[model samples]
Target: MSGTLHLAQALSNRRRRGRKKDFRDAERLVKRLVSQELTLSFVPDGEHRLWRTLTRTRYQRTRDKVRLQNQLEALLEEAHINLSSLVSDLLGASARRRCMR
Candidate 1:
């Protein structure tokens, strides 16, 4: 799919008009790949793919952790519980016991 638009444009007979979006998308992909901003492969590379998957998973988990921390902080605020002000880790043993009660 890389450089698909450029190839399509270059190969087009010009006997018919094609969708603008298609050409635009292809152009974007080509530019990104050419600029090395985007990485792609037509053949499967197991180790590379796995590394990519692992990084993506780690990123998603980090985002989830941040979201949960924000929600927890908001809930504590709503309940007038200022655990964060007292402890560095609000979900740690000390804060958890207070929250449970």
Candidate 2:
């Protein structure tokens, strides 16, 4: 349960190494962190993690919806329907009604 998270550049910049180099590094890093000496990383708390997950999922779903709408428009064009030209949004209620004809 006790360990250190170090940046690659920070680890590479340190010049000291021994047989227990990795363990020593972890110890030093933890000490620095506990004393507020290490300030390189910002590990987010649970609320921030949840917010990030929700935002990413919303963004991905919006992208997928737009992609699918574009594909549907392309299919309509192939059949000489020209849905994109007639309506601002191919997925709109008005457009759906027109397509149902």
Candidate No. with top TM-score: 2
Structural similarity to truth (TM-score) of each candidate:
0.54, 0.71
Range of the 10 consecutive residues with the lowest summed lDDT in candidate 2:
6-15
Per-prediction tally of clashes: 0, 0
Spell out the clash pairs found in candidate 2.
none
Pairs with backbone N, CA or C atoms under 3 Å apart (clashes), candidate 1? none
Tell how far residue 74 is off in model 1, in angstroms: 0.5
The parts of candidate 2 lying over 4 Å away from their true place are 1-20, 30-37
lDDT of 2 at 6: 50
lDDT of 1 by residue, 12-68 (tens): 223235666777766766666577655343544689889989999999999999899
The C-alpha lDDT values of all candidates are: 0.71, 0.78
Model 2 lDDT per residue over 1-101, tens place:
99655543465336365565777778876677667675465677789999999999999999999999989988988999887888898889989898889
Q: What's the true lDDT of residue 35 in model 2?
A: 78
> Candidate 2, residue 90: CA error in Å?
0.6
